[model samples]
Target: MRTHFCGELNKKNLDQDVTLCGWVNRRRDHGGVIFLDIRDKKGLAQVVINPETIDTFKLAETIRNEFVLKITGKVIARDNEMINNKISTGEIEVLANHIEILNASKPIPFQLDSMETSEEVRLKYRYLDLRREEMQKRLRLRSKVTHFMRDFMDKNDFLDIETPFLTKATPEGARDYLVPSRTHEGGFFALPQSPQLFKQLLMMSGFERYYQIVKCFRDEDLRADRQPEFTQLDVETSFMNEDEITSLMENMIRGLFKDLGDIDLPNEFPTITYHNAIKLYGVDRPDMRIPLQMVDVNEIMEKVEFKVFSGPANSENGRVAALKVPGGASISRKQIDDYTKFVSIYGAKGLAYIKINDDGPSSPIIKFLGDEVTQKVIDLTGAKTGDIIFFGADKSKIVNEALGSLREKLGNDLKLFNKEWAPIWVVDFPMFDEADDGTFNAIHHPFTAPSVSTEALLDNPGKSLSRAYDLVINGSEVGGGSIRIHQSDMQKTVLKLLGIGDEEAREKFGFLLDALDYGCPPHGGIAFGLDRLVMTLSKTESIRDVIAFPKTQTAACLLTDAPSSVSKSQLKELNIKVTLPTKN
Candidate 1:
C-alpha cells in the first residue's frame, strides 16, 4: 500500500518516485499549489500537488486534517526559503502526481498540540489521543524498556514463566480484585495483587531462576501514580542472597538507562538500613539528592522551660528532632505557616521553628525557653546564623512521618535538590510490627525468611529481622523482595505471629504452606510496577500518560462508559441480584 514510512523519506530519495499512504496532518493551498503534511507512525512528510496535476490538486483541496489519503509522488528538493530546518526530512518534499482519499474523518474534539486540553476529554477520546507524537513515542519507549528487561533476564538464565491470574486471595498487603466464579456457583477467585506466592512455589518446584512481565490487580483508591490494574516486571531466583540479587538487578537497570542515553544514573546505588534511614532522614526511603537531614535534639530540649519542647523530650514514645534548612532565614511568615499546615496532615500537632537572626534564637517559642536550653539546641543541630531550624515533637511515628514528609516538601519548595539520579537499597527491616490491637503483623509478608541469627520461632519474635530489601529510586519504592521461608515450621510461626491461626492459614494459604513442606528452596524476587517504571524513565508526572487507555480517578473507563448497569436477565443467569437502585 506504500513505498516507505513518512519519516524514512529523506535526502537519499530526493529524485526517487514513491507511494505514501497516511493521514493528512494538514492541507495548505498557496497560489495554485496544494501542500499536504502526511503523517503515519514513523512521522510526517510534505506532499505537494501542483496545478499541472489538476485532478490531484482538486482532490488535495478537499482534504482536511485526519483525512486518510494515498499519494504517489516524486521526491524533490524544497526551495531554500521553504525549507523547514526543524524536521529531519525538511530538505525534501514529494511532488504529488496522484491522490486517493481512502477515508474522511470528523473534526477532532480538541487539537492534539494544545497543552490546555483537559485530561477527561483526552481519556474519552484516547484512541485519537494516542495518535499524538508524544504519546506514540512513550508507547515505543515502554516497548523498548520491556524488551531490554526480557533480554537481560534471559541472558542471566531466567526462565520467562507465567502464574495464575485467578488464584486464592491471602491477606498480603492490598485488597484483592475479586472475580465471581460464573461456572461454579457462589464461589470467587481473586486476581493476583502480585505473583509473590506462586514464584516462591516455583522455587520449590526447582525452577531456580524465573521472570515474568505480568498483570496484577488491586482494589484501592486511585492517584496520579496508581491504577487498579497494572503491570510488573517480576523476577525471582533460588539460592541467591540479597547482595547477588541487588547486583544483577542494578546492572539490568544500568544497561537499560545506558540505551536510553538522556540521563546517566549512578553505577553504584548506596545502601541505607531501615533504622539509619529513619534516624538520618526521618524516612525509610530518603531522597539522597536532598542535602538536609534530621538532627536529634531530645537531650538538649529535656531541661527547657518551654513545656511544648520539654514535655516530649523526656517522655517515652516521644522525639525532639530538628531539620536545619540552609539559608532558610529568608522564608516569610506566610510560607512558614503554610508549612505548619502541611505537616498537620501527618498528625503533627504543631511545627516549631527558630529563625537564626544575627541576634540568635529568634522565634516566638524562644521567649519561653531558658538560655542553656537554647544554646544546647543550637549546638546540637549545629545551627548557623543563616540556617532555620524546624522541629517536631510527639509520638515517634508522628515525629518521623511528619518531619520526613516535610523534608521532601522543603526540597521541592526550596529547590535544594542536586537534580541528579540516586537509587538505593533499603534493607534490614523488622520482621514483625505490633498492630494497633497489640497483635503482631508481618511487616513484609509471612513467607519472608528471618535473618539467620533471628530465625528462632515462638521465642524472641520481637528481635527478629527479615531478609527483605526494597529498591528505592529517588525516594520512591520501585520494587521489593525477600528470601522466602523454605521451612514449613518457620512459615507457620510467621503466620501465627500475624494472628492467623492454623485453621485460617490453612484455608487461605494451604497450597503455599504445603509447597513449603515439600522441599522448598530459599528464593526471593522483586516486582517493579511497569507503568510507574515507564513513567519515571519518560519523566512524566502522570502514569496515565504512558498507558494507552486508563481509567478515571473513580476507576471508570470514560471511553467505554464501563461499570455500567447490566441487564436483569444477565444478572439472573449469574444467580445475582442488583438490590440498589441504578446510578444514572
Candidate 2:
C-alpha cells in the first residue's frame, strides 16, 4: 500500500515522491499548518500538510493520534535546527500533497510512549503494547536468534526434524498438561515437557544428528522465568560424546552473542563438577560472575567449646561453613540481622559472624568459641583486617544452600562481580539423588546414561556419575543434556532403580525400549529454554517481555481470557461429565 516504509526515508530520498500507510502517532497544529507523525512497523516519519495543500491540510486537521492514514508526499530536507538527532530517519521530513484517513481510532487506553502503564493494563491490551518500539525490537531479535540457530544447525549437518506435541506421560520432575481423549473414553495424552524420550528414540531410528525448535508444556507453578507453555531448542545426536556435543553447542552460543550484540565470549568456557559447584557456590547452576566461594570450617570447629559449632561439626549430616566477605566489616548490624533472616529461607537456624577488626577478631560467639578456635577460623578463612566471616552450622543441605545462595547475594550486594559474561559447563552429576525414604530418583532423568554400568549403579547409586552436562551463562541454566543408555537392559535397570518395574516401564516407555532393542547408538543432546536464553541476551528480568502473549502469574491470558470453561454441550460431545466438589 506504500512505496517506502516510514523509517526508510532519509536524505537519500530527498525530493523523491513517496507514499506511506501507517497510524498517525501524533497530530500537531502550528497556526494553519498541520504536522502528523505517521508510524508503521518500521518506524515513525514526520509528515507536514501546509495551507497550500488545501484539501489535504483540511483532512489532516481531523487526524488524531493512532488514526490510520495513507499519505502521498515528497521527501524534503528538514531545517538544520528542526532535525532530530535521536531517530535514524531524522535528517528529512515529508511534505504531504495528498492524505486519506484510512481508519479512525477512538481514544486509546493509554499512550504507547508512556512508561507508567501497569503490567495488567499492558497485557490486557497487548496488541497496542506490542506496537511500542521496544517490544518490536525484542520480538524481532527473537526471530533473528531462531533463524541463526537453524542456519548453524543446518551447516553442522543436523536435520531439522520434528517430534510429537502429544505423547505418553512420564515423570520428568514436573506435572504434565494432559489432554482428554474425546474418542477413547478416559485415555489422555500429555503435552511434552521436553522431546526427551522421542529425541532419544530418533537416535535409535538412525538419524545421526537432529534439532528442533519445538514448543513444550509443563503444568508447574509459574515464576518470572517460567510459563505454562514455553519454547525449547531441542537437539539429539548419535555417536557424539558430551565433550563433542558441548563444544559444538558452545560455538553456536558464542557466535550468537557476538553476532547479535557484538559481545565476544571467552575463548574457552571453564568446567566444574556438580559436587564441587554445590560445595563452592551452593547451587548446581552456579553464577560464575560472582567472585565468592564458601569455605569449610567443620574440622576446625569440631572440638570447639561452643556446642553450636561442635554439635553440627561432629555429626554425619551436619556442617560448619564460613563465607568470608572481604572488606565486609563495613556491613552494619542491621544488615547482618537482615542477612540472618535471608538465610532462614533455606532452613538456617541462625547466621554467625566474626568481624576481623584492627583490635582482633570480634563476635558474640567468639567468647564461646574461645581464643584458640576463633584464631584458627581467622587463619582458615584467610580473614583480613576488614573481612567478615559469616557462618552456617546446620544440616549439610541447609548449610550449603543458605551459605551458597548468600555468597551470590553478597556478590551482588557488594558489587563484587568480576565480569559481565561468564559461561561454564557443570558436569559429572550423580546418577541418582537419595530420598529420605531410602528410594532412588534420577538427578536429570531416568534415561540419562550413567558413567558406570547398571550393576555398579545398582550396587552404589550415590557413587555412580552420569555423563550429563549443563550450560550456564551468567546465572541461568540455559541448556542441559546427558548421554542416553543405548542398551535395553541398562534402560530397564535405571527405570527399576527409579521404582518403575518391568511392566510399568513397558507401559510408559514401551516404544522407546523397543527402539533400544533394534540397535541404538551411543547418543547425547541438549535442550535450551529459548525464552530464557532470549531473556538473558536481552538482559530483561521477565520472560513475558520476550513472549508475544504471555499469561499472568496465575497462568491466565488477559488478552484472550483463556483457560475459560467449555459449554456443557461441548463436554457431552467429548463424552465427558462434569463433577464439582461442594465449596467449603
TM-score of each: 0.95, 0.95
What are the per-residue Cα lDDT tens digits for candidate 2 across 313-367?
A: 9999899998889999989999999999999999998999999999888899988
Tens digits of per-residue lDDT, candidate 1, 1-584, equal 99988988899998998999998888788988888899998889999889888887777778899999998989999999999988887989999899999999999898878899999999999988998999999999999989999999989999999999999877887898887777988888999988888888888899999999999888888999888888889999998988999888988877887887466778787898998999888888788889888988888878878888888899987898999998998899999999999999999999989888887768888778767777777887888997899999988889999999999999989999986677889999988887667788888887888885434746777767889998877777777888888888877878888888999999999998888778788788777878887887887888898888888888899999987988888877778876887899
* Clashing pairs for predicted structure model 1, backbone only: none
Rate residue 259 of model 2 by lDDT.
Answer: 94
Error of 2 at 510 (Å): 1.4
Against the true structure, candidate 1 has what lDDT? 0.87
Give the lowest summed-lDDT range of ten residues in model 1. 452-461
lDDT of each: 0.87, 0.91
